[model samples]
Target chain A: MRSLFHEELETLSDELVELSRLSARALERATRALLGADLELAEQVISEDEQIDALRRDLDNRAIDAIARQQPVATDLRQLVTTLRMSADLERCGDLARHVAKLARLRYPVCAVSGELTDVFAQMSEHAQAMCLRSGEIVSAQDASGAAELQQQDDTMDRLHREVFRILLEPEWDGGTQAAIDATLLSRYYERFADHAVSVAIRVVYLVTGVWMDEQEAASRDHLGGGGVPRAGI
Target chain B: MRSLFHEELETLSDELVELSRLSARALERATRALLGADLELAEQVISEDEQIDALRRDLDNRAIDAIARQQPVATDLRQLVTTLRMSADLERCGDLARHVAKLARLRYPVCAVSGELTDVFAQMSEHAQAMCLRSGEIVSAQDASGAAELQQQDDTMDRLHREVFRILLEPEWDGGTQAAIDATLLSRYYERFADHAVSVAIRVVYLVTGVWMDEQEAASRDHLGGGGVPRAGI
Candidate 1:
């Protein structure tokens, strides 16, 4: 029974990695669609998000089942619960990618990102994709070190996001109201995509270390009797 | 033992209502800060968010404890799990409110929203607060009809969000890129706040009716062997 439970846990971990890869590819295609004004790629990304949603639903159901049947205690329980939260974060990432695709489709033929802002968006997209890929690796390998590196990548995305905003705020910006709105929303989509990736990575760190990313949070949890219900010894 | 479990469930429901009230007030104050350029009010909203976070943590811990100790099955189990999800949505609502407060602070003495956009934002804020308060009532009473009404309110919010975008994209818009960015993010914060409130209300509907908001999802779940693992009719 113990071995079977371990096998189920491994399967859950593998599914998360798969979901992460899907999210990364979706973001890649969505970015390409936005930059190149590729309506076909945008449509594909939008349609494929349903698959990501289905995968998330399946993973959630499986996690709940594992808890119900195995009655996993302590660390095992935390792992399952954390998996549910990570899947939610990844699913939201997919939704953000779809939003990008919708924007690309909306502007079709005329790139929503115009002028010098294109390069900034291109860089942001690359950073976001890299962060998603790294998150997948951390999930499959449980590599706490890789999770730390993802945070630095997220910082780069943040800087790029601010750069997009700064350009929009410049007096020389003559992209007009439509362009300003497009740039503002697009930058946010990429920034939030990176944020969700960072959130998943942080959860990974917590799962492995049993320590939250926020030091104050960790201390508070200790005061709350170890953050969750005390499980009976298996 | 059954009576004790019921008592715990009632306590969890009450906590959810309290969390909902906190979210509503946060949105109200954050909006006031944005429109009035009240830095003190904005600071208050931002600082008080930690208390909301703490309350959500406490509720989540209690729900988990109920699950582990009582081992609730079927509807009882679904209710507990759904409570956890609802708490998360409420916590995110608090975060969105904080984001609005931060925007207000970023602009300081100068209002982030200006000109005709102020009225739109003011209306959106009212809608968001109304939705949160209604969600609280629905959660406490399990008012399925009230839950349905909240969906219509969310629809109004969605319409307002689109209107904000329309005004931003107007050829005559001279709010400057900074104002445009501020309007875009602020509108989204309010829209997302409404969205989370609607989500919590829908969860209540499901908990009471076992019917998903999406009929197609319900059909799909039915095909997945009664939606979750088959409990042994405990």
Candidate 2:
């Protein structure tokens, strides 16, 4: 019976990794769609988001069923609860990716962001993908050791976010107010995507080490201070 | 034992309502701070946000412990799972509220949003508060009937969001790109805040009715179309 329950937990963790991968890839394609103005790719990301949402729902139902049947307690039960949360984070990552895709689709013939700014967005997307895939590895291996590295990666994402604001607030910004809005929203979407990945990885750390890391500080959502708001540090 | 478990469920439900109220009040105050440029009020909301976070954490821990101790199955187990999800929604509402307050604080004595836009923002805040308080009532009563009304309120928010975009995109507008970005973020925060409230209400509808409401369509998140992005509707 215990072995069967362990298998259930393992399966749950595997699905979590799969969710991470799905969300990560969604963002990557969404970025390509945004930078290259690929309407087809953008539409694809938007439609495939349903797949991620469906997987999350299925995983959540199974997690609840396992608890009901197995009557898990202590670490066993915590693991199941944690699975629900990690899936949610991944699902939200999918949503952010879809938002990116939607922005791409909204701009159609024209790329969503200004040409000069694509480099920063592309960098942000790359960091987000790396964080997401790393999160998957942490969950699958049940390893907490990768946390420090994840934090460093999150810091890099924050710096990139500030970089985005710098370019937008620069006096030479000829992108217009509309483009500024797009850049702000786009940067936020990518930053939030990376933040969710760190959240998943941090949860896994708590699940494995039982040291109880503070999840709220998973990544600094407070990192961005837009416009005249004194962008967080140079 | 069953009665005791039911009582535990009731306690969990009550705490969920408290979370709803806490989040609602936070948004109300955050809105006031934003419109009034009240740094003191903004700081209050930011500091009090931790209280909301702590309540949600405590409630979730209790719900998890209840499931472990009672070993509930069927509807009982589902109720516990729903409690966790609803708490998460309310907690996110609190985060959105804090985001509003942070925007306010970031601008100090200068209002985050300009004078003319405050009417729309205030209207959105009112809708958000109504939805939050309504969600609390729905949860406590275990009533799904309010779902329709909640949906209507969410519609109002979406309309207000579009109005913000219209104002930002106006050719006569002279608030500059920084202000446009601020307005954009502010509008998104409020719209998302109300959306979370709608999410909570819809979850209760599912819990009580067992009719399996399609929650993804709880409210249209795809409503906004910014810049040259062809705002969704007139």
Best by TM-score: 2
Fnat, one value per model: 0.25, 0.43
Tens digits of per-residue lDDT for model 1 on A110-162? 78787899899889888888888888889888987776688777668767776
- Tens-digit lDDT track of model 2 for B1-234: 999988998899999999989999999999999899999999999889889989998999999999989998988888999899999999889988988898888877777687579899999899898899999999999889887788878778888887887788787778877777778888878888887888888888888888766666652354334212344321
Which tens-of-lDDT digit does each residue in B83-192 have in candidate 1? 98899999888888888888787777787788788899999999998899889889999887787688778668767777787777666777767777778778777877
Flag clash pairs in model 2: none
- Return the lDDT, model 2, position B42: 90
Backbone collision count in every prediction? 0, 0
Worst 10 residues of 2 chain A by lDDT: A225-234
Best by lDDT: 2
DockQ per model, Cα: 0.21, 0.48
Off by more than 4 A, model 1? A215-234, B215-234
Residue A137 lDDT, candidate 2, scale 0-100: 95
TM-score of chain B of each: 0.90, 0.94
Candidate 2: tens digits of C-alpha lDDT, residues A192-214: 88888888888888888887676
